[model samples]
Target: MESIAIFVDVQNVYYTTRQAFGRRFDYNALWAKLSQSYRIDIARAYAISSTDPKQRQFHHILRGIGFNVQLKPFIQRLDGSAKGDWDVGLALDVYETANSVDRIVLISGDGDFQVLVERIQQRFNTKVTVAGVRSLTANNLIQAADDYIEIDSDLLIGQ
Candidate 1:
């Protein structure tokens, strides 16, 4: 069995799915589907920390599904802007883990990850699968991935 690593951009997926389908991404469903074929070695979900009870519950659910939920403080800017992104941290972790795993699965629609995907493929020769809402996902990111998984009804809650 090939070892695989999974990375989820929690905020990106959350917003994209809500905006595109008005539904939530089903982490449990994703885990079930992947476990059937891959030896999952590392599964991490990057998210912004919040004190909301609902957010806490969501994180707990992710943990129950076998993910190590990494949280960064949500920043509120003086200019009414907010900043909380895991691009750098996620990329670093993926680069470090790429050599050890045969495949990597990244769940996000962020175009910023295009470079990371390309680099991982070139440096580690590992297969990279990207999962994101088709209409919202960036063309460059999708093109860079070794395989692209569309976040359709099958991966959405209440579908």
Candidate 2:
């Protein structure tokens, strides 16, 4: 079986899916679907700590599904804007873990990762599968990835 790693941008996916489909992502279903064809060497989900009971419960649920839930401190600026992004962290993790896995499955629609994806594929010779909601995902990212998995109804937790 091929070795694989999964990196999920929790906030991006959560917001995008909620806005586009009015539902939650089904991680249980995703794990089941991916495990059949690959030996998942890494399954990490990046999230911002909100300290909400529901958010904590969701993090626990991700752990139950075999993901290493990484949390970043949520920061609210004086300007009334919030800052909590795991793009750099996620990229670093992917870069460091590249040698161990044969393929990477990045679950985010952020276009900023296009260069990183290209670099990983070119330098490490790894296959990158970009999974995101079609309408929300960046065109450059979709084109750069070795494969793209469109997020649809099947991957949603609830309607």
| Candidate 1 per-residue lDDT over residues 1-159, each given as its tens digit | 889999999989999999999999999999999999999999999999999999999999999999999999999999999999998999899999999999999999999999999998998899999999999999999999999999999999995
Consecutive 10-residue window with the lowest summed lDDT within model 2: 150-159
**Per-candidate clashes, comma-separated:** 0, 0
Error of 1 at 7 (Å): 0.3
TM-score of each: 0.97, 0.98
Cα RMSD, each candidate: 0.8, 0.7
